[model samples]
Target: MANTKAKAPPIIDFAPFYGTDPTARQDLVAQVRAACLDKGFFQIINHSVPATLQDAMFTLAHEFFALPIEEKLKVDANLNDYHRGYETFRSQAFSGSLRPDFKESIDFGPDYQPDHRYVQAKHAACGPNLYPASVTNPAAFRTTVDTYLAAALGLANDVLRVLALGLGLQEGYFEGFATDPVATVKMLYYPSQEPVAGEGGDDGERGINAHTDFGFVTLLMQDDVGGLQVFDNDTDSWLDVTPIKHAYVVNLGDCTQRMTNDRYRSGLHQVINRSGRTRYSIACFHAGDPEYVVRCLPRGIGGEGGEEKYPPVSVNDYLTERTKDSYIRAEALNAT
Candidate 1:
């Protein structure tokens, strides 16, 4: 059972890091390290991304999702080899439950052409993005999204630098992994649902089921409708992550845990939207360069035997295996 007095995720102000004060920078790094090792989650405020841009991205999401069902289907993600387009509502089941997640999404990545190195080599989840040309202003939609993606990538870069420092490495330690990154920006829509009785009397159908992410890190921007919850290992309960205006909810992924040999956690979280209003969120899943090998960092291999918890694996191989498992699980549930 979830605790009635649930703890909220720690909120950190990130703007101070931009100043030239070394103490401020170190303090920010310490906060991030603590969050990663504890809850594996934190909320960031006063970041570089503009508020206007975020609002514009949400507006574009509304515009795209408002299209007719047939119009949206023209870019069905399943039709393409890269799954870079639209994914239908309730088509994904993240927790191995019979009930699929009640959400629809459209994914966009770096618009690589056929001649790009990754695309030419047929890398997993690497391809050009698909935009809905049928929208009222298709050009505006694409342009705004592209701009927003750039902003998200910028924020990710800064966060990665902070993470590197927290891990006791040079700020540029993660740069090698970023060369030709396979990151993605996903726009998700979850419709309102009837409440169900469970862990907290508020637990309901899964908007997104309980699962850990499959990459280096995840950065999410969500609207006012509350549903996101993070599992608290200490209290053995689910805690609500209330939205902070224009703030990003950042979390580590499985790959990060693998790199740290489990010293840092990859927390499990789920969404349950019973607010009687639709929920919209944008998540940037930042995977590293496909070919980079993820090995345990020196600082993390410190058990009695100094052994690594997980063997080294390439980014592509890890993501491919995880992605395959997700699809298979979703398909199995849908078939039931």
Candidate 2:
């Protein structure tokens, strides 16, 4: 949350993700994997989603927020057991010490299956999305948002494949856990830029309070205005991370960290809106299937003989705790 002018990454043309570019793509994959192992984050280019789609999404977001406060309140997130709808300023809480991120967000993801055994119980944090049926352009709105989600999900698949390969496993080593994963996409709009309005000298006091991602990985499309910062494990500095044109900002989540036994770090990421420019970002969260147990891998362990490293747990248990911190409940982690 400190006001610091950080250098933006040198802009690079994205040749890696485009078709028929094998060498470049492989190199791209290698770089991302390396970054994931070291810092657990990277900016990617050439994973294309049409400019038209991005534009429409922004347009609809504007209209959605412009609706009368009364109507917006009707869909406020607190009303539902599943927290997948309109969130007014200060609704969602962050880790202790930061002011509520000065923003409002619309969160949604793939619908849950009707036969999903635990739909009524496990997914109190998963529910129907809030959409204004009275929008001016529903067609353009749905198409663009859906396209953005699909694109991010596809990119996630590619990254997971590379990760499996990068880890010396068959390509689909991670695929078995991905069935009907609890994918989430959130649209964030930080308040209009203003002088830092809150007390400083403490953490979590910015437009975006700092926290590590909770799912497997997160793919984000941010506007040109820079505010994203990532903790640098090597430098011990919270370096500024700006969006590169045609690039997606990617980072590992806490679950990935636990599963990997810290092989990958789920570094802290935060956004500052100092430019006074309203920022728009579409972030997609990738998760494992609800039933997938996210225990440690054989290779991730290092026992007394330096053989293995971690205790076993399921992805479902990990993710549920991540989203609601109530999966095992506070008493469970605290039990004697």
Candidate 3:
């Protein structure tokens, strides 16, 4: 994390979003709109996800990462085609110019069966997830992850409703986009690092490189050991995303920006763990339905407007292209 004294992003009380009061809900919508326009990042407090569940998820993350590399590889993501399961450290370079990220991760998504429509249609990200049977209490790990995923997706949906209203559209405007969504629940482990010694080392190596997310929105739960930083386009500097107790750090993604013709900023961000201890975070990337065509909305263009900045694209194609670009870099590095 940056110095504790540094400026922090806005933290909104999300309870109002679910309340019966229309005024309170609109107030939240305005706050969210401002945050998205200004920084593309904000923190949400008083969310409905249980603290106990969050704690359990973190516990599983710790336990899973502590296992020997051999054991972790049993559920390697490469085993499947849908990009689920374990990813080794230095396996990705989000910025393309920097060294590969120094973090390990495990990803899980909605486990659709072979007969399911999306699976049958061969949607790029739809398939059964790879669960690590090698973990102690494997059943607990699976159950905890599934339980938290459902809760996180619910919260993401509520946030989407707020976003729709914020854009001057109906609250249900985004509901259709969310059907049979492509939600990824990922656990990231950033190992402690010693400062780099040579030229460019100060900013070259990273736990994860600078990049905007690829989906509709990201809801992240990070532990106290924080190294997350959001880029400030105004100052051309990075601002640390400080950890907040029991709050999710929500941010917009490229797909959302495209759908809104850049009305919602999907800002750049990266992680660098200098805390001298491991850092854990759970990020749920909600990309909505694979088949939904992402087109600019009338409200997103505004009355004073210019022409649409992006052409129509399906959620599946966009996500697949981005994921393919990322792994291509990883594969190049792996071969060296």
Ranking by lDDT: 3, 1, 2
Give Cα-based local distance difference scores for all models.
0.86, 0.67, 0.88
- Local error of candidate 3 at residue 93 (angstroms): 1.5
Candidate 2, residue 234: the lDDT equals: 50
Model 1: colliding residue pairs: none
* lDDT for position 204 in model 2: 40
lDDT of 1 by residue, 157-231 (tens): 889899888877789988898766998999999898887667656433688988999998899998999789999
Q: What are the runs in model 2 whose C-alpha is more than 4 Å off?
A: 1-22, 113-115, 118-121, 193-204, 300-310, 325-336
TM-scores for the candidates:
0.94, 0.83, 0.94
lDDT of 2 at 317: 68
- Superpose all Cα atoms of candidate 2 onto the true structure and report the RMSD in Å to 1 decimal: 5.6
RMSD of each: 2.6, 5.6, 3.2
Candidate 3 C-alpha error for residue 247, in Å: 0.5
Error (Å) of candidate 3 at residue 192 is 1.1
Superposed model 1: Cα runs more than 4 Å off: 1-6, 197-204, 299-305
